[model samples]
Target: MEGDLGWWAVPLAVLGGAIRVSTPILFVSLGETLTERSGRINLGLEGTLVFGAMAGYATAVMTGNPWAGVLVAALAGAVFGLVHGLICSMAKVNDIAIGIAMMLLGTGLAFYFGKPFIQPAAPDLPSIPFGWWSDVPQVQAALNVNVLFLAGIAAALVLHWGLRATKPGLILRVVGDSTDAARAMGLRPAVIRTMATALGGAFAGVGGAYLSLFYPGSWNEGISSGQGLMAVALVIFARWQPLNCFWAALLFGGAGALGPALQSVGVTQGYYLFYAAPYVLTLGVLIATSSPNRALAGAPGELSITK
Candidate 1:
């Protein structure tokens, strides 16, 4: 294990791990940000994430194209989002409740259909040799960033700008902040919300694609490993901002990478505890944010989670 390259590779490994481990989370948090910005939250994205992983893996196996798998995963995730949006839009329906149900439905469906795909190996997504200049193998390996991670960064920038400067972004904010205001502006709140939720689902699905088509590079029921659920905390920590989601994901990713980094340095003891760093951070953030004394700054007016 090189003992973390005589203690030097430790940081390098962590930096690499943060970028690699955070990709799926970055995607899901981005999706959740869009959904929440429209005054809705898809708690079932865990399911969407799992289902997308299955669908993407299956597609890559059948089509021999990792990109096709990613595309199909997005479409499949959109369908889940569309279903959630349409259902929640109905009278007397609770968005949170429907999201829970959707999560169950998505997981059940995936488990039933994904059984056959467990053992198959699908094509992996390619990585960019960003560390081409580095002669060290560890450095090169650490620097070989995946294309999707770069894409997620680009997405964060675009989403950040879009929400601040674009007309559609304005509508999303209006719908999230005040449904009545959106209606008064002659905009359909339900429609806008539905679209936003669908797009969010698509991004979450792409995250799934990243799991099956890239990192782990295979399909399995345990592939998601609660990362989908963790994305909610990530989005909250980001204060619903897309760019913040990017930073928050890296933070979580670094925490996630901590255990492996330690193991890489030949410190195998208590690695499990290190692995728990992200969940512990999630708990801390939630406990901190859940305080009744302080209002969540920058929260959308109509967001129900705060209320």
Candidate 2:
């Protein structure tokens, strides 16, 4: 029984950690997938994530309602995305550069405005206690599933279906594939792109809310841990597919859980290296998938980097 316990614990811990840690990535990557499918890249989601964390935390602190906080975070994220979309819509402006500027601006504003709410306690998002059937304490703790994670999964399914079958999805794909074609079809590419970007930003904000209002369950400058940035690469690694994003997020989440999972079982050597696993995996995926002669399969034709 003792030997069996040792063998099973760490994997179970990682299983739980993967679900917990992957929620943010799932949201952010889904959002980025939407934006990229519309032929725009918003590198500023990192800033949006941080700002959303601050706004969500602050709102929850004031309203005493975690749902309200999630709403506010989504709104704030939309505003950031709108700004990026508007700026990029202008002629002679570079989308990537504008995205970077927005990232810095969003982060700066979050830091500046969020200073006062740092120490306040806020209500946290509720979780579903799926592990109630388990007698093991670790199993119970690991099975405490957040509602947002479930929502994200539902979203992935909806997006995958919508993109493949819906009219709006067709329009987005058309615009992304060729701006000239969209213009010929009387569809304003800029308007479509802007809307997509804003919607994407709102998704990212919700991801941020999950971080500050649930997992880490605190408002602080260090809350994001670059999940926002990592999401961009995740979207690419998933080959721009929404369902693929879900699996990639879990993989990344499991990678993220490596150090802590090992530690839970008394294996803590090279702890920092384990923590770095996600980034390393990301870099490796990018290198393997990258092509010098062409854009990635399924990548939008009008995307700046691809061009």
**Model 1 over residues 54-164: C-alpha lDDT tens digits?**
999999999999999999999999999999999988888888899899999999999999999999889999999999997788999989899999999999999999999
**Tens digit of lDDT per residue, candidate 2, span 1-307?**
2253675887887888999899999999999999999999999999999999999999999999999999999999999999999999999999899989988998899999999999899999999999999787788888999999999999999999999999999999999999999999999999999999999999999999999999889988888888999999999889899999999999999999888888877787998999999899889988988787543888999998787
TM-score, structure 1 vs. true? 0.97
Kindly report the root-mean-square deviation of model 1 from the true structure over all alpha carbons: 1.2
lDDT of 2 at 201: 95
Residue 285's lDDT in candidate 2? 85
Q: Which pairs of residues clash in candidate 2, taking residues 3 or more apart in a chain or in different chains?
A: none
lDDT of each: 0.91, 0.92
TM-scores of the candidates in the order shown: 0.97, 0.97
